[model samples]
Structure formats: structure tokens, C-alpha cells
Target: MKKIIVVAGLLLTMGFHASAEGYQVNLQSTKQAGMAHVGAALKLGAESMHFNPAGLSFMKENISLSAGASAVFTDLEYSKDGYKHNSDNPIGTPFYLYAGFKIYDNLAAGVSVNTPYGSSIDWGVNWAGSRLVQDITLKSFSIQPTISYRPFEKLSLGAGLMFMYGNFSLSRVLIPAGDLESLRPFAAAVPSLGQTLDNFKDIDAASATLSGDAGVKVGFNIGAMYDITDKITVGVSYRSKVKMRVPEGHAEMNYANETELKQMIATVNPLLIAYKKNPIVIPPLDKGTFSAELPLPSNLNVAVSYQATDRLLLSGEVQFVGWSAYKALNVQFSQEVLNGYSINAPKNYENTRIYRLGGQFAATERLDLRLGAYLDESPVPGEFLNPETPSMNKMGLSTGLSFRPLERLSVDLAFTYVTGFGRDGSYPYVSNDQVKAFGGHYDVKALNPSFGISYAF
Candidate 1:
């Protein structure tokens, strides 16, 4: 039972990578998505709160509002030992809303609501890797209240308070049908137990479901921006790490041969004691609860943008993710129910960086064209990769356009394609005091389409 809780924590964290490289989502703004999410140095009116809040003070209008959403479709394939399986991932819709007000000549205030992390992936229950993970889903949202100030003509600073909420559920096979033969020795010692085991020896009979809610957590986002010249700007932003904690979670067990399993356990207990081995304890699922904690690593972004010509603008940025903070995962179960068993699993994730470049051209009086690309490094090591999150280095290409039919209203559309480099990896874990490993080749790809509308006056 303790092992189940430990594995559940891993699945919950790993499951977050369905939409991005790690537990992150960058679909905060349609305009920025078209530019590979690079807007740290650009003054994007109300939509700048997520990228760099300092840009808000540079808005030219008294009021600005933007709302957008993206549909993410992902495909993942796995192959090992001539066996193949594919992930049935549902379409993920990440959306954002922002409203900014110019309070004074040098002051701006705004609020943003968005889905920064979430995922859903399902591999059939009978798959080869069912013992590791069968299905998982995670959902999260954050609300930020931000303020920006221009202390000087060329320098602006900003800050925001982030309130975040998240929840997850996952299922996995507890025991595989192929491993039942290992218990034949004990079964042989008890005649009735042997008959019960032989009756359904090849059936995948046991599984578990773990679900939890991460209560509200608080964090902050801060940023600074400076005008290097009339046509050049530079900016830096930092988003603090938020620790998501599940105080009490639910776990349930299912057995295909419940009556037979109970009978076998009762029959085998005396034989095991005769051999001086510990007896199996039935899991107390009806009243048991679990607790866990996972950090939503911090990130820093530095960017520069140049207005080269009257109709052309170019921007670039480098993002440093502090994934090293996630050194391990810990889960604790209630002592009253399970003897207070706890497990601390080491992850040893390393920090990574992302590179982005984008450009926008004012094609006509009412149209703007944009193109961008980015390269994201995988944070998970090859040896620790698992089926739940087959993370690999990836490249993304994007294109978009904005159309203005009315003077104060603009419509936006953007599309992005992401492809991961094929890789083979393995995940090793301990089961019943024995080390076991699961390995395979994985390939992944995703397509994203976004639409939005912004109005400023």
C-alpha cells in the first residue's frame, strides 16, 4: 500500500508534461504564442502581465483587455520488445484573460487568470506498461493581481501576487498477471489456496486509483524593463516557485477475484509464519488517506527587442528554469490506517534553458504577420524517463496574424507545431525489495491552434 502511494506521487508529477517540456504551459497569450511566447521586452498592453508585467506601464491606452484560448493536440507512441502502444490524449484547452487599467501617467494595474499547467493521458489498462501507469489527468489554474510603475522615463518595474489551485487523479495496475507464477511456491504449501490461484492465475486482477487536490498556494512574479533607446528595449522577469501540497488524498483498491484473494491470504498466512516470513496485510482503502508535496519550479527570463524599421520588429529571449529544486518526491499515509509508511523517491532533475526568436511585420494598415521558433531542452534524464511523461528535447515552429477591422479592436490567430526527438530511456524502481526496470522507445508530437480578441481605447 505504501508503494502504491509513492508511485502515485511520481505519476502525478510526471503527468504534467503533456502540454509542455515539464509541468508548464505557455499558452498565456495568443500574440505571444505566435512569437514563440517571447514578449519579455515588448510592451503588449494588458497581455504583458504573464510575460513581463513592467511592460504594462508602457501601454498607450487608458483601458486594455485581452482574452484567448488554445487547443492542444498531442500524440505519443511507445515501443519495446516488439510490443507497441499509443497514448490516447484528449485535446487540452488552455485559456487566459487579462484586463489592465492606466491609473496614472506612470502607473498601471491589471489582473490575469490562466491555466499554466495541466495534462490528460490514457494508455489502455491491458498495455505492457500498465503496472507503471494506465491513465492520469491534472488540472491547475492561477489568478494574478499585478501592478506596474514607471519610476523614470526609461525604467519600469512591476510585481504580482499569484494564487494557484490544482488537482489530479491517476490509476495503475497493482499486480500483473504474468508475475503470478512467482507465488506458486506459497500456494503449493496450501492446497485450497493453490486451487484458488490456479483458477485465475493469468488474470490481471488488482489495480488502484489515487486522487488528490492541491489546496490554494501563494507566490509572486516580479519584473523590470528598461528602454535602451527609442527603438530598443530590454527586460528581465522572475516567477517564484510555488509548493503544491495535498493534505489529504483518497486511494481506492479494486480486485477482480476479491473473495478468492481473501481466502488465499488467510490460507497462506500460517504457512508463511512457519517459514518465519511476514504475512500480507490487506490494504485499508475505505478509510485511508495520503499526503504529498510537489514544487512548481521557478523560472527567469531575459529578453531584448528591437524595432528595426517602421514596419518590422524583432525579439529574442532566453529562459532559465530552476528544475534542480525538485530533487525528490515525498508521500505520507495516515498512521491509523497503514502504520505511517512513507517513501522519499529521488528525482535529481537538472536545470534547463530555452531559446526563442520571433519577428513581426506590419503588412498593411489593418494586418500584421508574425513568425517564430524555439528550442526546449528536456529536464528529465534518459535513465529516469517513464511512460507517464516521455520527455525529450523538442523544437517548435509558429506563425500567426492579427487583423483589425475596427479602430480599437483586433482579432488574432496563431498556430504552432512541436516535435520531439526520438529517444530510448528507462525507469528503475524497487518492488518487494527487488529492483525492477521498464524501458522503451518513445516519439511525440503536438499541434496547437489559438484564437483571441483584444480591444483598447
Candidate 2:
């Protein structure tokens, strides 16, 4: 049998999903989450900083503040030939805070601190596909200071500077086979198999596991809204791409499985020694740090709102993700020998469009009810849905309510259930540079619950 050895290059996919639009936590405001994030054109005040900062110009209060968080629960199931393996709950909590104040009759300023982009995926300690990934954690936050101006009676424009920070970490088993018995045949096939196998036979006793992180990134956002009629408004917004660089990262190893490595080396030593060739020399791992770069994508959104009646409001929005920019993963390690090596993964992610429809009703003088639904198209081409991120297209149902116990204070709550579309992606060797993931069928689902409070003065 031909020995197929994997590369020891640095991982590039680490930064691929951090700021993904599909992965961005929408819990910054329960009000928006409940309405399927529909308020771009009609929204006003602090929370508008996320969907469209320009909406802040319509605030009815002199000052407003809101805080909230979302609890995300997700599940992914993998199946091969009818058998299945389930992923652990990749639970993530994203927090949001926003403050807005009227600077003048037609101008406003606001600040928002939130976790807009992030994810956590854990496949656990041992699995049928340990090489794929064991765990993934991406923590990101953005502090945006924004200003909105209503230069015209029915129009508003806004811009903000996004001070973004995202930290990425990943862990996976590098080499699954640690036993000498399993290494023998793979070793015996080396001379015919080439350097990959010859190098595998000389695998470092300590290099069986891998892990690392990407330090930080920065970006920005711009938006505007226009009133077409007394009861109609249109909105547009753009968020710039974040550029990230990890100058140095650490990868640790456990030597508990060194026994098999030693035996493999000891058994191969005699033949080479007796044959007059130099005995096998096990290479030294002797390094811990590496460096890499991964850039997230950008996005544009257009939304509209209509006042259908005195007690009802209607909304629809379309968001365009620039995923086509994400074409490949590139990483450069720090070690001298590894300096020439890189782990590159191809993610031919295509641009995606998300559609949302929602409605809001004033149930009473102090109460409002909101309901909505949306379809999110996955940018990840099935061929690219690897163990690290099995991203898929989904449809979600959401409902929420806001109750004003006092004239100045209101509490908001929302619930969202997203159902994912599953598929079976088979890996067929396409190109020399194209690396494929373990072939399998995947099923996924998510539940999001959010709570928040807003106060105006």
C-alpha cells in the first residue's frame, strides 16, 4: 500500500470563520433579534449602531442606553455510510452594550461594545475523525464610536470607527497513529513512497498534537437612511473587512505516546547500521512558536421599512456578504526548517445573500410585539465544509416582545430557532493544492435566546 503522509505546515484555516457573517452573534439587542434584525430603516437610538448607525438620528429620547446577551446552543451530527457521530454543544455567549445621546435636534452620537463575530466548536477528546479537529474557539469584540447627522428633514447619514479585536485558538490531533506496529508497514513503504513517508518514519517523538492562535484585527463601518415617503424609508450600510495578523503562536505536545516512536526508531536502526548507511536519526521538534495571517471578509446591507397602519409596521432587508474574497488560507511558521513550509487550505467561499421579513405591533400603550423569519444561505461550498467548520445554510423563526414597566424603562426579550439543511459532501481529489476534508454527511441546528433592557432619559 502507498503511504500517504500529511504535511506538518502551520494551519491557515484558524482565521477563516472568526468574523463570518453566518457565525456573527446577533444578540446585541433582543429587540432586533426578535424582529429578525429588521429595523435598519425605521430603527432609532443606541442599538441602531449595529444594523445601521444612521437610524440613531430618529431617537425620541435625549439619551438612551441598552445592554443584553445571547445564549447560543448548536449541534452538528456527522455520518458516514449510515453510522453517525454527534458534536458536543458548541455553546457561545455574546454580550452587547450600546449608548446613544442626542447631540442636537438633528444629530446624534453613540457607542457600542459587542461581540458581533465569533464561534466555538468542540468534537470532544476522541472521535472517528480526530485529525479533523477536536475543538475551536474564536473570541472577538468591537468597540464602535459613531456619529449620525440628519442634514435633511427625512434623511440621515452615519459613520463609525470599529476598534476590533479577535483572538483565535484551535486544537487537533496531528498524527493519529502512534504505535510502532502501525508504523512498520507505513515505514516499509517509504523508499518507494518518497520524502513524506521517509520523514514520517523520522517523526518527532513529541509532535503528535497541534494548537495555536491569531492575535487581533481592526475594521470600520458606514451607513445611511432615507425617507421616501411619510410612511416609507430605505437604508444602506457597509462594513469594511478586518485585516488580522498573528506574529507568533504556540503549539504544545504531550510525550505520553513516545513509547511507539522509540520502538519504531530502534527497530529501523539496525538494518541501516549493518548495511553501512548511517543509522536512523529522529528529527528534533525543538520549537514551540509560529506566525500566520488570515483576513476576514466584508459586507453590505440594504433594508426598507413601511408603516402599514397606525398600530403596525412592516420590514424587509437584504444583506450581501463578500465571501468571494475569501479564496485561500496562508500561513508562515517561525522555525527555520518550517519557515519554508505553510499550511494552506482552499475555501472557495462564494458571496451569499440573506433575506429577512418581519413585523412589529403595538399591543398597548406600553407593550410591543415583534415576529420575523429569515433564510441564511451558507457561503461555504459543500466541498469546503471541513471538520473545523461544518457551516450550512439555514432558516430561522424568531419572536420577541418589549414591555415598558415605566415611561423611561423598557425590557426586551427574544427567542430564535434555526433549522439547518444537511448534506453529504464527498472528497474527490481535485487539484494538487486542494486539500479535502473527511467525507461525511452533516446535520446541524441552533437555538438562540436573548434578553435585554433599555432606558431613556
Task: Give lDDT per model, in order.
Answer: 0.83, 0.71
What is the per-residue lDDT of model 1 for residues 147-245, given as tens digits with 9 covering 90 to 100? Answer: 999999999999999999999887776665544454567654566656676764666556777889999999999999999999999999999999898
Q: TM-scores of the models, in the given order?
A: 0.91, 0.86
- The TM-score of predicted model 2 comes to 0.86
Per-residue lDDT of 244-315 in model 2, one digit per residue for the tens? 666776666544246654565566556545554454443232364666555556778899999999889989
Query: Once superposed on the true structure, which residue ranges of model 1 sit more than 4 Å away at CA?
Result: 1-15, 184-203, 260-282
The lDDT of model 1 is 0.83
Task: Tell me the lDDT of model 1 at 218.
Answer: 98
